[model samples]
Target chain A: MSEKFSLSIEDLHVSYQLSGSAGKNKIARAVDGVSLQLHPGETLALVGESGSGKTSIANAVMRLLEPTSGKILLDGVDLVPLQGSELRAMRRNFQMIFQDPFESLDPRQRVIETVMEPLEIHGIGENQEQRRDLALAALAQAGLRPAADIGDRFTHQLSGGQRQRVAIASAIILKPSLIIADEPVSMLDVSLRAGILRVMADLRDQLGVSYLFITHDLSLAWMFADRIAVIYLGRIVEEASAVDLIENPMHPYTKALVSVIPVPEAIEGASRTILSGEIPSPSSIPSGCRFHPRCPLFRELGEPEKCLNEDPLLQISAKSESHLVACFFSDPSKGDTQ
Target chain B: MSLLEIRDLHVSYPNRKGEFFAVDGVDLTIEQGEFVGLAGESGCGKTTLALSIPQLLPEHSRIAAGSISFNGVDTTALNEEGLRAIRWKEISVIFQGALNALNPVQTIGSQIQEPIRIHDESVSKKEAQDRTLELLEAVGIPSHRASDFPHQFSGGMRQRVMIAMALSCMPKLVIADEPITALDVMTQAQILDLLRSLCDKYKLSMLLISHDLSVLAQTCDRVAVMYAGKVAEQGPTSRVFGSVGAQHPYTQRLLRAYPNIRHERKFIDGIPGYPPDLSTLQVGCRFADRCDVALSRCATEVPDLIDIGGNQSVACHLVSENQVGVQ
Candidate 1:
């Protein structure tokens, strides 16, 4: 365990047992042996398609769902074993921002009440007055100017962007060490998305808050995240700096995912690698290399038997220590591998 | 000849306070086999404008003035029965949210065949089924799975089914409203490719409505940027999105907000403040409150869409004045 890291997940595994109609038992490995580390004030984005277990990892870290096996360590404390008041106490160190601001925020609660509820639940301030003052300051920090006026309006009265600002205000009011934002801007309009992203970035710089930003938009991940982790099914297929991942993606899935992102400028004669089929269900995960069924490179390599027999571990590349890829065929030294 | 021409079209709905213009004075035209995209934020009335094309507005809503001319015919003056003649035979719609648009209790084939049967009663059941199979295959869905229910398919597959349904009647113009919004990036690309190819093969005109500027930039031949029920800018996709130049500050801001993979990290400035309320009377520019380069006159004078040559038009006092001076 590194002391420099603010949050670390060691071999996290979350599974759900399901009973079939014929009384057969099956296990869905939502988070299958995933591990990640986030430095203080660092932004790490988990980019994947839906049903790729990104939300499950966030849920496990928030202690909303129990992990079958793994260590969720925040500041050297293993949160997997913590429960009751201890878990509640640990929750104060981390907060979450959800996708839909309208659904996440209570319609009846005013902006001030929503932001102050966190402080009240944690029993941080002495009374309502102090909490209200802190909430107002947080609102201003979130770029909602004239905080007192904006704080008086209810969630329904505010725009989608304003509601999201309120949500950010609530998340940062606690001054948590880490914030897990799940598609925070996906629900908002395209123009409003950048504003929320900027707020999150500024908060990290000012308060030294780390972020585990989960989103399906890879382009957004490239724009904001310092480090990008591409997840497939329940495992991290590739993890590298944003620049490295976007410019030099190694995993076959990462390459395909990056190729499909619609850029504003049309690159003439640019051929895209479109994967053939949808992501397989978590309950029926393929054996060996999980992505081998849809791996265009694997088929191009004459159906390598090794990919069908051995599952690849996420291994650091020889070129860069920070760049890791979970594929045997992604050796950058070989010119033909890419 | 233009396939669809909307001139100063205004749609309004009465509320507790008064009538609110959802689709205010807007002029748009789509040539034969042209793909025109309408891009805007939510509640900016892009959907309302698209819905008004087929006269699908709600009961409370009414077309206040102007005209919608399709194929040299005035569509706004058509009655329900008259409109039905052109609805599926000439124009069709692929609505948002494929999951809800499809009926769960019915098979995909039946839903697709309904349009074909309604449009042309002479077609036999077997021929309709064959056409349904062909439509399904065209959308990249396996023909054997035509009997499958909506729930049996993936999100992308359901979207394909929706496209297949929209194309069953072979309409000349298809209005696709956010066809791939919720799907993954890969699926979105596939859907867009399918749409482009289908439009080309059928020589069909399309009106694609989405909040995503990148999607519009990639798909549409020409783009119309709407803000608060007005067309802020309209031009060729290359000029509007590419370096040729975007005249409107709103369009520029929208283009900047989207992260382009080809470009390096650039500062994205969000347009401050929410869109102005539609129910309230507006005398000047709707985007003046958020416009960074707005002049004092901008708050008092509403600018009309002015042509800046090269098939580009803008509705901003700043850009129009600059262009007029240059000319």
Candidate 2:
């Protein structure tokens, strides 16, 4: 059972209390009853725009933010109840890679020191020399050749791609079974981002590591992830295989997102579904569907009265075992049946 | 005649070790009512080139050579007073980092009104306020929200305010440097659509600078690929990124790196090496070290921009030699 999956999040809810101008507090449900599962060596991308709780989900999983309630089961062991040394020991099984490599790494620390910090903190290596050797090996594995020379230089001395490689080395040095990467290559140049993606994919293949890859860019997720979960507001709106999600999106939000992505091809006369308004604030999330206000399909479907009252739960498609969507109007038998 | 022309422009900043050439020998032109895009990675001198057009370079930077002509007027030779007259009146810039660019304490209305008032003293305060409301409405923001401060607005609204401010005077040309870089996908699409529509409505020539190639392809009529402070390729967007693909090795590599939603999934090949250090002068092509199609002569002889017909040009020795043989 649960051991088959690398990480499983059950009914996760992360809320924050914000004080208003009048000193009254309001609860912001960043991650509202979200659930996901990542198998061994699989990449599950949580895709969404800002304020969509993608990063909140990652933070909650990483234990950087405490969740209001949820069960985070890693290898059949519940992580929420762990504390002190037990939690510290559990951290080695899960690691995180942040968005901006320049800011993530300490400027004063050398590359070797940055990567070795995790090993030293966890008391993995017996001696400093052994730790240095392991750090250099991880750097080599991360595609930074002449690892000794690279290890001697400070983070500022390296290029953006190289700095990201260092970040990856640090994350993989612990050989974590799961890596929570939050927009890991978003800050790097387009020419440089592909290299980092290749490195991560290669590392996953070699180390059998799963990833909770969270990003705003759907194209990147489509390129790398095994499965894609589209989140809107604070809930999973759609989930499917990468190919299925991109080729045939069932949810209106996912369809709009897919259409808006700027493809390299000319795509002449391709009609784009432009949503009218910006994402609403999390504190005052819209009632019912949560996306009804800006959903173009909501109007196209003749303004379903049910969308304004009853929220749809995520349901597995009858056509396919893997595809799941949380929309009342998205009938699985409509088009491209599986 | 061209709306704007930059010939052999050289801009540098004084570092501890002599001058660092942020924008080396570069030549570019924008036709009237044309939308041109400048695409490059960070530190590739795209921003420096845009800043040089408006004489808005930072304090330590110096214009080392060449001239910038706007509507046949040599902008580089203009005096301070003359340049100020042409800045917001003839050309305006929508700077990057829209959130920090707007003043926090001031209302969006006042900031949009600043340019309108400064450029024309004849315009009254009431008139300027009316024009601010008009500009806000044009950029898709509500006119009533003009009184709201920047912090009250979302990221997308702040960007719309920036666009409104740039359109306040209705200059002949607009230079937007990474306007939608920090925004989300939906917000980015909205801004792009607004920019395209606004450009059409006003018939304004635009220089849209961004590191994202897909963005450039979506917005611009022509695209110039910049690398290591130089234009590696320049052509119509259709030909530059057409079925045949970009001719310059760097341009092709860059285009290949981006994941196209229309295309099937495949492993994207990344450019292997880092960009050359700007301070150290190189004899041959700056991209020779990382280029896979580099010939032996690429390390010794610099390649000049060669016209490859169909309004497309490339600065690669291999491409130029192949074109010569075909001719």
Candidate 3:
């Protein structure tokens, strides 16, 4: 709806150089020429399985790991060229939430100190007491009740959900423009997931902050994200609105991903597609269609020549012209009813 | 007689504060070849109940009350040697993160063979090797990869090996605790299907423990919801997890906690508050504090699991009161 995007990733490539023996290749293309955009205040979900380079894309945007090539633009400004102090200065605008709160939080620090650390790092407050006040405000925004009491407790004293709320408090302390949440609820209990998600939603509504929510669960994406991008083998196989993508998945991998989601309802005879093999190691990615080996549609079509010989670039789907897909034989009407 | 029956079981572990009754009065039964699921949040004593089956609890923890009968044998009264003999032979346990429990120094084949050889010492080395390969094939792994070390296998494959080892001695009942929690969704489906097929093919009774309802809904014939060491609800999967059949407040909330791909998008809030402390276990239902529609009597007296209708059991004062109102 707006001309300027909150986060625009352009032809991003992140590859890791391999040492010693690893098949015939010496380099692993973790993320290869992927592009995406997140509008301000919109939640865009990056849906992919392990080793699909979803985290690599997040790390690259955060400059936790330098991209192999291409531009990571923040509000139309290229972040790839920014160095030391500039990158550090730019970091206050964008924050990251990790899957495990234990990994991002310090064990020795009190909850308030951890939340205040961000303000201290950015030099936002004039005094220590002022920073503590700001930290308590952020904690309250994160839905931590009795903010002062919660702030006085150490990280180890809190429950799993409380610990993650503290992590959210720290990430939101500086009122960042963009927050990249990587599998934020994957490590939490199923019941606790919705509460944390609700907290994030309330924050989004209040702060008008954009979220790049990365997760492996499609159902969560369907419930939370406005747009969903399906990634496979370091490439975007499909991208569309959440309802459109789930209702009419063009890519075979996306179809399979949707099929295997076990619904707890007593719906009889819900058929599922379990992909046969694990994702290929990044160093030895298949040419043409990277998902050919596991694509049910490709095999059902008697192994199309185009899928084996020539690569399929991300293009508009035949069914929904607006939907992007990277499969040569993605049919329009093949989405599973289950 | 059922294949496995646990009657009013209570397990306790002593701590600095007091005696922590991790598993308080739980009763469950599994018919021969029945697939049962136990689900709850962490520290809800689902794991404690599963471990008590094979007498796998640590030395300090003791079964304070109740009996666990397997194939008509009283497992609780058995000594260590007797328990060891019955463990892999009659009741094997597939632990959570059991994949990492594999010995990295040994080959996969050798690890599987260890259980087979130990159970049947009279068998020859060749016989044990043949059985190992057969078990591997049963679990969808190629026999040739038997020589591969644990490091060579993927997470799913390592889990498959654990399953294969669990079946090495032809155990009648298998207790898998959160078997697929560490796996991705696709791989988790594969493993669950494999276990389902294996259970059917061998006529083996299985007790699948997981915090997730959907995982159990797809595989288990019956599911039991636990809360703070008590069986909140237990019934057929269709009746317990269906759109409108869940009765207990805890079970109802737990059922909707997961995000279902087919279900319509709606605002779902988690059950508020934390699980009650086991060491300070008190009167009334453990879920009373978190329950939204809890009656005043719910906090004062514990309700027994009553058969409401259609073989469904619920431990809630609300359901009992409704039944009373109807009468």
Write candidate 1's Cα lDDT for B13-105 as tens digits: 999997989989999999999998899888899999999999988899999999999999999999999899999888999987755778999
Lowest lDDT sum, 10 consecutive residues, model 2 chain A, at A329-338
Write one digit per residue (lDDT tens) for candidate 2, span B1-327.
899999999999998889988888999999989999999878899999999998999998989999999999999999899999988889999998866888999999999999999999999999999999999999999899988999899999999999888988879999999999999999999999999999999999999999888888888999998999989999998877675568999888887888877877887778777889898877899999999888999999989999999889899999999998998
Model 3: pairs clashing at backbone N, Cα or C within 3 Å: none
> Residue B49 CA error for candidate 1 (Å)?
1.0
TM-score of chain B of 3: 0.97
What DockQ would candidate 3 receive versus the native complex? 0.71
| Cα TM-score per model | 0.96, 0.97, 0.97
Interface RMSD of 3: 1.5
Q: List DockQ, one per candidate, in order.
A: 0.67, 0.75, 0.71
Local distance difference test values of all predictions, in order = 0.90, 0.90, 0.90
Candidate 1 lDDT over residue span A242-335, tens digit each: 9899999989999999888877664555678988789988888898899999999889899888789889999897769999999988775644
